[model samples]
Target: MNGHFPWLTVMAAVPFAGALAVAVLPAAKRTLAKNLALLVTLVELVLAIIVTVKFSPDGDRFQMTESYAWIKSFGVHWSLGVDGIGVVLILLTAVLMPILILASWHDADGPQVRMDGTAGESAAPRSTHAFFALMLAVEAMVVVSFAATDVFVFYIFFEAMLIPMYFLIGGFGGAQRSYAAVKFLLYNLLGGLVMLAAVVGLYVTTADHDLAGPGQGTFDLARIAQAVSTGELHISPGAEKAMFLGFMFAFAIKAPLWPFHTWLPDTMTEATPGVAVLVTAMVDKVGTFAMLRFCLELFPNASKTFAPLVITLAVIGIIYGALLAVGQTDIKRLIAYTSISHFGFIIMGIFALTSQGHSGATLYMVNHGFSTAALLLIAGFMITRRGSKTIADFGGVQKVAPVLAGTFLVAGLATLSLPGLAPFVSEFLVLVGTFSRYQAAGIVATVGIILAALYVLVLYQRTMTGPVKAGVEKMRDLNVRELVVVAPLLALLLVLGVYPKPILDVVNPAVDDTLSQVEKTDPKPAHPIQAPVEQAAAVTPLGGNK
Candidate 1:
């Protein structure tokens, strides 16, 4: 936006610094740690907002870039920058952090005595510091992962994110924390390893190609993109598809689309709601984000070659996830399945390769985060009251806590693409865009919306309606603290639902740029040929009386 500024670097580092501060501060001083973490994230949010405000969508794809030599042996650079796409996603990451900190305040720092029964008061805060710290650390990784202009740099951040989230579940979750944490870690770790293999291939391939009239290709994505743009570097069809599949495998698992989604419901169900929100709303976004940023950008031919297969999987994930969600008894698990369904739409939009679809996919990432945050946080509140995530455990909740029920319902409606809600706008654009290319895929995917309404309304009906269940009469309405946590998200959804132009104005340009990189467009529909003597010459229908 201006002269060389390290704003991107600062935005990424602030969270890490905050985590370090939390780690070194007296563990017993829980309030200090919480306050410090909150302050750090707030400051990061402020910086992110400032940078976003300064970001002119019409400007260069990468803005406020910062580059430095790193691991020069193979020609890597610690480069950072943001296009409109990266800027918005970075904003999503920053925006969610402060809210999550607020949400976790009670859950992570509540009045629970130590299980060991030794200095219970202090232990609650001390243990929770790790939770907050890890969250912030994950935020830092997300910022860098999105903003990194270097391919290798992105890979580092990509794998780096799993560490904090791994501990967040295993360290401070439910009775099955260890099992859930291991499963989550193992799945992501394996995906990362596969991605690493691809990264290594690119490293060697770029080197051998002697790109840029030079000895070896650099890891800077900008440079590689430039080489390809100018026709200086060429990839064989086989190599392109191999690398594409490598990247796709990792992202698909992360997006947890269809078959790759088994780890998700388990992780979301076992994770604390705060962690669940972080993982589902933000972390899972990395999958689709990488698809747009790397897979398509770097391997355009392979992307086109595999578009049909990918779209089929996306459509399948949509229907499959929605169906499973409708049958889920656990509310948290249900929400997780819903995200898998939503991700199907996001991926479908991206592969549609239409300007509108990619734009909607980008916006979907932001809207999905907000809507998911509202649902998970409100669900968190409900679970805290009932001490259960089972849908059957709740009934007549709206009578006892009107505000909670209302907010939860609004969030659920948004998830189901209710009009006048944030998600509806993006979801609409995605379908409109996809229909232009493949009507059948778009139509099949739309079926998921009906299933979405079924699952959400049914969950609401089961949990918040009917006579107050046993002990539900005592459940309190949303307190100011809880209201504070969800209000901003609702406000965002409402404003965006009404006027998404501000985001789209920025998003469309990036989408166009991405489509250009992929060198693909929506194939026009076929028009049947007409004959001069059409009526008499045309083939008659099977049952027609000739």
Candidate 2:
């Protein structure tokens, strides 16, 4: 599959082509545009599944590889490949795109209705074609980002994605959409600028040191990572640290860790739920994923040097996000804060630098995407019904709409990482892995779990448990279309929660490879387990000797 077929290229290109086609469709063909976009995503999803099926976890570190010389002068190539991490994330993106399209079916149509159920005549019209087309464009860019083995290629799309997303937020969002969209764009653009400097610095360093070969340089991630691993490329500690900071600053803001996280709540608060899902669940994942692929692999020594500081920041984010979530009066804002907390766990696991940690972090990324989608999309539906995003606007939702309230409860419980839910397995693995080496940090991170319970349960109680609010009296249950969007997500949560081995099988080998690249090994247990024969022999011998 490496060169026989252009799987990765096709996967990215289909949606890009679809986006073009959808964007150009006549405004009169709005439904056709939506159908065409959904069809394209479904086709993309099928291709992704084929790639996943063909992927051999035990085979090469990067499979389905495709490379062609794109810019000879710059020593750049259009290279695409996927390790286990990329495979799962790509699949996650493919799965979510269609669901989001369906979830946002009517989101871009006309102006929003007022809380009194009156249509707002003053609101601006939204273009459905642009909305769906922008979403498809985002999918294409994200797929490319995941599969790109050329650092230059990756950076190009990484920054390019912000364009479509800016429009998606500002064009199809709420009252403060313009403000939120600007803030999101500015924050990420600043991060991208910083990353561009580091990208250039890396290319220069490779050229100066001849990391590729004598009198040559390369921007291929695999080649450079191999050079670093084998000691063929020796970057000075100071230069590596500086480059690491440059790359890290960008990803941190993308990951939205603690202080850098200010833009997210505002962004999600204003964006349509589908756009919110795209930003938080799928788009933001690129940041954390880059940390694993770029930061750790490309700068292993710097990774080791800065692991503690990174872990500390992650722990703080966990606590900070959870605490804010507990206090949020706005439903969307609350979910946004919880995502910040979840990302903290993901980042902490990545920096923990062990097999379990890495594996859990990767799995957590996938699980969080689905869980967040389920919760946020459902909340969006509720908000549409009540014409409000305030937590206090609805009460006794379960009494009026049992199915909706039930699903919301399940999604909320998953958010709290309750036992027997999708997030629980990933979160547990993260703690176990982090506790193995960074005990104090792990211990503090658990406070997030307690806080998560407080927020999730309190939210459920306030909205769904008490007597019905005045407006919620006639609230409807999950409609067929809405159920189509949510059922799969919830099913995945349940399936993965009890049996995470399938995903683990795919990610574990990659995690091991990453640990090897960084020269990390899991910490040994304090008390080793003895073989049964040894234990029996010791017990009998002790009795006889006594």
Candidate 3:
């Protein structure tokens, strides 16, 4: 069933097809476009599921690869493949796309939520189709960003994403939509430009190594990875460091790591609830994805050299984001801040460069996507009912809307990496791996877990446990439709936590492959600094070695 057609290609094409169909239709037929988009997303999800089932975990490399000449003269190709790591993320993206579309279905219905807790009516703007179109576009771009094997293709998909997202925010977002859109675009553009410079540098360096002048050089990531691994390619330490920073800066900003993360709260605050879910829960993941794919795999030596600095920033972000989250009054904004803190754990795990760390980071990305989506979606519904995003505006939501409250608790538990939730296993693995390799950094990162518990529990207590606030008293529980949308995420959060072997079986091999490459391109020192320092004083007291 899988081999008959290029399922991956079809999956990539579905949304584009939907977009084109929607674009040509008259504004009167916007509903058709929206329906088509929903269909396309469902189809993509099914394809992803099939791909997942058929994927061979034993393969240990990219599978179902599809390659063709894109720009032959300069060695640019349209290549797509998914390793175990990429496959899960792709599946995550696919799964979320349909759910988000469903979640957003009510946005364009009409602006008329009654104070009596009745469903509201929105203005009959053509925005329903427009918003869905942009989401599909973003979905396509994000999938490509994950699946692309060519650096140039990856870069284009990476940057092309901002356009749809900008429109999603600016066109369909809240009152401050324009401001949020501009800020989101500008910050991401800056990072993209930096990444562009690094991408060009990679090709230039590769060209010189291959002795192919100008555009004659190739930009195949696998070929380059092999070259760098085998010493067939030589990138100077300074160049490596510069390129690494360029890529890291871009990804870190996208990951919204601490200082570079200011754009997130503003963007989330101004975005439609659905758009907020996609951006915070999904799009931001591309940054961490890039970190694992490019920074560690392509420039291992630089990654190793910069590990201490990266780890420092990660820990600071963990604490800083948590502090900021605790201070946030807006529920959406608080979740955005919490995402920054969670990403810190992911970045810490990646830089830790251990098998468990990398594997955990992969799983964390998947788990966070589901958890964030669940939380944001629930929050969105709450806002729709109450007409406010401020936590202080409502209370005793559990008493009024027990189903919504329960979902919130489930999602929050996952966010905090509770022991029985999906993120728990990944977060624990990350910490364990980090402790094994960088004890101090690992220990500091544990504080992030504590902070996560604090934020998630506090958020729940504020919104759900208090006495029913004036406006929230009559709110209804989640309807069957909403429950249908969130049910899978909750089930997976528990199922994966209980039995992670399914994902780990596939992910560990890829992590091992990446670590092997990292070791080759950037071998560890005979004695890591921390290991020696700990033993140094003891050895000195023993009069040194004989």
Candidate 4:
């Protein structure tokens, strides 16, 4: 890599470059395209790891920053950087891309099965190279979304990703993919439009500040955060509330929480497993990420004012998502609902406004991405073998495919927040953090956790523990390659569950800095949220997982 050139920019460009390569290659050279795509993803992952290692965790400021002039007249420029939060998310995006590629290998080896009631009829693999290429392209955009420092630049990458993801789901998904793709686009674009208005509002405000202050107007978030910290920019509670809702609506729809969450089940059920992984695990996190990066940091007073409502909604989502999941017969749809429920917990932690709460939220984002990826990948593998995503279509799979059953069990247990799994630590932190702030919400969220155990365990029993369904008795164990693909994810789930400190050490400083900024601007009232005795006692020992 060139020392002066921006490595992250190179990471973004490499996938598009690969996509071009894939497009130009002869159709007969599909294998070549596949290899090239894998190489590109591997390179991207390496770049992310390099960025992580090089990041200065000691400094809460953005690292490996690149800035340049773009639209000088509007005071907008291309700027990108990463702090600890960005590092893990960027790395998570990188990690999933390769796993996705590996998950698709079996699909590439075979053909699409026609739905003419034929069980094993084969058609040519569904343009496996193109699928991988599009996935990499989406990964690149995800990286950009996480790394961009300027609001305009962030908006560009944030919105541009839909183009590729839309096609990926629509072109390569199962039945109803087209409808899912359109729904996804409409809902996200609606949110984006609102956020775009906010971005414009921000620019206007910045200009006004520049006229009165010593420096020029800028969209640099660091400058904006500093301005807020020093009271250079004063947004009234009313204006702050509106801006907060604008950003909140956008992220909520993306996070697909509660009322804004109708699109998720449809998209997940219809899209291919690989695409679903990104939609749920990676892209969706951007919404929560934005809430933390922009909503809380930029409009702390509004967040505090809105905290009670947000926590109430979050609790409702937790219960509602779980109930919906339990009612769903479609396996994919069930998982999608479970995600909504889990995300509710994440948002609750964020709005709880405690240090551990934020830490839990951050860790939840990371753990949820990995754990969800593992489940979706395995789900894809099962669907490919059994040719159905309905829970009724599976039974006693452990007898027929022990290895597949094992992976599913591991993923499902993680989903249930089993102790010593990645989610367990994060979820515990969230509840503890929430209990510290809002005892009632925390206690209710714990009920959601218990429900999680129900749905997940029931799902596992229904799918893997009964007598093998008539059509499923002959299903084969995972192939060598599939095992290789899932092994790393499974290992990490256990490793991080047991020892999350390394990741936390890096994440805590940035989280602390962000909360500190919020406090200085919107000082905590003398009376913080009061917790019930039992709930307070429950979370006291954890100390917010810090």
Measured against the true structure, the TM-scores of the candidates, in listed sequence, are: 0.93, 0.97, 0.91, 0.91
Q: In candidate 4, which residue ranges exceed 4 Å CA deviation?
A: 1-5, 106-126, 211-216, 520-546
Stronger candidate by TM-score (1 vs 4): 1
lDDT of 2 by residue, 425-504 (tens): 99999998999999999999999999999999999999999999989999888899999999999999999999999899
Residue-pair clashes per candidate, as listed?
A: 0, 0, 7, 1
Q: What lDDT score belongs to each candidate, Candidate 1 first?
A: 0.88, 0.93, 0.84, 0.84
> What's the lDDT for residue 328 in model 1?
94
Shift in Å, residue 487, candidate 2: 0.4
Candidate 2 Cα misplacement greater than 4 A, ranges: 112-122, 530-546
**lDDT tens per residue, model 3, 168-236:** 887766767788889999999999999999998998888887634543566787888888889878899
RMSD of 2: 2.1
- Candidate 4 local Cα displacement, residue 526, angstroms: 12
Q: Where does the lowest 10-residue lDDT sum fall in candidate 1?
A: 111-120
